[model samples]
Target: MKLNYKEDWPLYLIVLGVITMIAKEAVEVVLTPSKKMTSETNKNEWHQPSLYLDNELKGADREMVLYGENLIANTSYYFGPHGTIQPITNGMNCQNCHLQAGARAWGNNYDAVFATYPKLRDRSGKLETIASRVNDCFERSLNGKAIDTSSKEMQAIVAYITWLGHTVKKGDKPPGSGITQLPYLNRAADPGKGAVVYAEKCQTCHGNHGEGVAEGSGYGYTYPPLWGDHSYNTGAGLFRISRFAGYIKDNMPFNQASHQSPALTDEEAWDVAAFVNSQPRPVKDISHDWPDISKKPVDHPFGPYADGFSEQEHKYGPFQPIADARKVK
Candidate 1:
């Protein structure tokens, strides 16, 4: 007997639905492995925490944090050659070195400052406070005299640094808190090779003579001078080849690079640091630095080291030998 087609339509539809469900299950099985891999990769990544000073923050704490961030981001505006406030420092802001007021990861950030200070430092050879550390930068890096630690500006700066590291517990140094360390080269870094890299990659912003670009108002530098009377003095941390090279490896060419994807090779970073440091800049009296010569870093760039290496060897590398000698001792 022939079936009635309209009466059988619902039965046909149910069979079609069952076939569609089986096909979807087969497709999911094919995609499952790739989806699991993506989730695993995402779970392993780490990021620097965001800093906030919004409405939730109030009273003097908020004021201090806000002013501190402003001071760091605009240090040149308040303290540079033609500054409205002090006019004492070379025309470079704290952010020029600290990068994003010390919030950026592996960008010379202050992520460990609050947790680590009030501790003994090898450079100073004394128990130091956060305020003393800030003044150290003022004296050495800014090529200027120190401000009073009790002053509003100083307090604000300390407060901001503390706020940035609030999530970190005392005695714990979080990942990405400081400069990214690059491996040492087997041979001495070459100034001549660095000069070539500077001309090709750095000169457009930092200038042919390393005399960085000036702001329109003529008060501070838009791009900080790498070497000059207006640049950081000889006692600056960046005067060291290793420190400078690591800094360039993570952040350089003025925002063209990052820790995740650096623009310069390790050798190029070392060479460029050597070239920049070889240029003329203001000198600083560092007789008091590293009170114990034995405690001096392998790349201290000065004589009187416990190891008998020449000053030239100390400034540029093959620094692994010096480090090895220290380890043996």
Candidate 2:
């Protein structure tokens, strides 16, 4: 059959396009590795590892893991003022900060803890063991004394964290290992603006004064406090406005938000963080912190910095200037 070249051109082009697409896909399949291998290469990709206890662990190890999970989920029950084990920490569970016993993606999960500990940390300016790191949280975040490293509770917690990150290679930080790093705002975060946002969005769960709702039993908080004696101390990591802002940007207003669909804008997050941290909380003697003042984070919120910036500027920042200065140095 004699086909008219001009009239039949559209049909020929459509057929050629379809074949090209098929060929391209075929070539890609041949050239690219499988999904698993690609995921291994890009370790940051979300691979929601199951919390279900694996068949690999047996007997005492299994018991320890379960206990650790319980401890993380209900830390206040064992360490609060009315604790059955030891009345040490303010009545807030570890899960309040770590989220889902440190399993939730970008909710400050311990996905990289096992893989990355025994590494140098700028906060203390020392190579810290996982046990030392855990103790740091106890002292600062929980506003409590450090549990003995040899204690069963400490060992169990380490075991659980290790179990969570067992699959990840050493020094590899999986995506969503910690809170999302929100970008620095150009202007200083305003506490006044944040107060409004808190009243509208956060007050119901966290209370008007940031005193979280107490659990019915009065042992722990159902919603952890953001400030005051009961909350994380001034030396805590979240005391840093940037860390708190990043955390809030990724997860806040309870279950209404997530990293994939954050409820607040970067500006709102930063402002809210500023407001929250500006409120009074427990004061830790951080005289020993950041042995090398030059290595101190721009957002550390304390004085005696290598830079001439005031503590106010450090706490509620247009932080890029500090960052830029550091780069120049």
Best lDDT among the predictions, by candidate number: 2
What TM-score does model 1 achieve against the real structure? 0.85
Provide backbone clash counts, one per model: 0, 1
Who wins the TM-score comparison? 2
Query: Local error of candidate 2 at 306, Å?
Result: 0.9
lDDT of each: 0.87, 0.88
* Span of ten consecutive residues with least summed lDDT in model 2: 41-50
Structure candidate 2, residue pairs in collision: 44-175
For model 1, what is the alpha-carbon lDDT of residue 10?
A: 89
Inter-residue clash pairs, candidate 1 = none
**Candidate 2: regions farther than 4 A off:** 1-44, 51-53
Deviating ranges (above 4 Å) for candidate 1: 1-56
The digit string of per-residue lDDT tens for model 1 on 30-56 reads 998988876664454224455453556
In candidate 2, position 160 carries an lDDT of: 88
